[model samples]
Target: MFFLQMSGFPGSGKSTLAREIAKFTKAVIIDHDIVKTGLLEGLELEGQDKNIDPKRAGGVAYHIEWSLVDFYLSQGHSVILDSPCLYDVIVENGTTLAEKHSAKYKYVECVLNDIYELNNRLKNRERMITQIGPVDIPEERWQEVINRAKKPTHLECLKVDTSQHVDDYIGDVLLYIDK
Candidate 1:
């Protein structure tokens, strides 16, 4: 089994690249936004307050995401974890999960070199509503997220510039997977 973890800021095309990789690898995608949305729905179903705290929901979603990764890996299936993964703890936990399953772990970091383009992408409310559902942060907050992201130093990661079409890098990603 192989475990692929994606790290990138919002609107950096992490999910897009994950899907492209999944098409070639046939890996199951554990998208953080989808999981967090589900957790929020579960909270609503449980009669919790209508305005559920994003942080609390995100914590539960991450827990569930890791559990799902473990479960799928245990079943000998490759998994693509699609998330920002800005924190070291998240990367460490993913590494641990991969080791526990005796699977090859790979990390992919997507980046947009042009800040203006990234901000423009983030400002697309329709796209955000379709993908992440109204969780778009203001343009000013994007820098904070980028500043807080701890780049993975301990592991060899593939750095992808997602400012252009991601298909150009699919072959490279496939080669990495073969490694």
Candidate 2:
């Protein structure tokens, strides 16, 4: 099984492209935002404002995100983890998990050639539910997430600018993986 970890800023098309790749490769997509939203549902967090502790939210998201990946890998299934993973620890975890499970791993970074398009997409995206829970996050939180996104190193990952046509983007990724 191939474990794909997609990292990118919000509205950079990581989720859309991750789903596309999952469809073509028959892999499961584990998205962080979707998981966090689900986890927050019915929870009464005081001042749960977007301005709340970002680190706390990030930690929650990290735990849920990795747990899903570990579960699927244990089941001998390919998984695509989609998130704005700016931390090296998370990336290392993905690689280590793949190694320990004897599965192939690839990190795909989705970049945006046009910032405007990314902003529009983030603001207008329809809710996308997954195993986590609700998929709708507050706009302010979304903005905060994007603002904190960091680019992954290039040594062991393939970077794709999602501003290209869908066919081209997919083709490029396929070719990259094949290489």
Candidate 3:
């Protein structure tokens, strides 16, 4: 069993790659964005915005995602966390949980450095409540955010160039996990 931690910017194809990997490995995916979006939508629907903001929703969502990860791993299922790895806390949690479950810890970082490409994808992609809307963040910050992405220092990380066809690099991920 393996716990694959996905890392990338908002429009860097983290979810797309995670889906492909899940299709092949049959791993259970606990998508952070989906959980956060659900929380935000529930609040908006119930007129409860005063109770929690998007930032808090993100925290709650990650908490839920980690719980699901631990649960699935404990049940003998491989798991994938489809989220940008931006914080040291995330790395610690993922690594510790993997060790606790005696599962291989895998990290895949989708690298998309082109701001125009990222913006175009973000602009046209299916809208999610917690997703960036039409590059709402300043373009200049995109590179900074990408540079700020975090990963485990001691693990061998698979750096996927997002411009390549998934068929090309998906095998590398599979081999990495199996290795």
Candidate 4:
């Protein structure tokens, strides 16, 4: 099975690209923010100590995501996950999920041109609230999370710059998947 996880900062166009990829490839897309936000609903970072930790939110995202990965892989479907998966825990979890299912996995990192565009998108974006919850991460927390986002190396991953034309970037992803 093909498992694709889109990684990038919030409002970096990962979700939009994931939708495009899913449409073209007919793959199942599992959005991380959607899950994270759902898990975040009614739950404010309440305190600056425990609740504000990005890792804490990531830990929650990891379990939910891996579970879905397992479920979809068992059904023999390719999975496309869209989220700001910039933490080692997320990458490690993705690797673990792939190993457990013996499925081929790919990581797609979305690169935005600038913070201005990203902020604009985030401010106007409408996210889906699934089983997780509604996410209302404050500006400070958003920066904190971005600063903590892990940058992937030339391991078993593919990076796509979303600032480019969609067709061009997506073509690269399709080519990578073909290989």
Predictions in order: lDDT: 0.81, 0.73, 0.88, 0.70
Consecutive 10-residue window with the lowest summed lDDT within model 2: 128-137
Candidate 2, 1-179: lDDT as tens digits: 87888887767878888888877778899988777665565243544454445467667878988888888998998899888777878777888888888778787877774556765676577754322222354654655555454443544677787888777879778666555
Tens digits of per-residue lDDT for model 3, 26-82: 999888989998888877788875567677788899998889999999999999999
Quote the positional error of residue 174 for candidate 1 in Å.
1.7
RMSD of each predicted structure: 3.1, 6.1, 1.9, 6.0
Residue 75 lDDT in candidate 4:
86
TM per model?
0.86, 0.78, 0.92, 0.74
Q: Which ten residues in a row have the lowest lDDT in candidate 4?
A: 127-136
lDDT of 1 by residue, 1-179 (tens): 78998988777888889999999889999999888877777777999997877877778889999999999999999999999887787888889999999998898888875667776777764452124432345667665655565555777888888887987988998788768
Candidate number with greatest TM-score = 3
Residue 158 lDDT in candidate 2? 79
Candidate 2, residue 41: the lDDT equals: 53
Backbone clashes for every candidate come to 0, 1, 0, 7
The candidate scoring highest on lDDT is 3
Residue pairs with clashing backbones, model 1? none
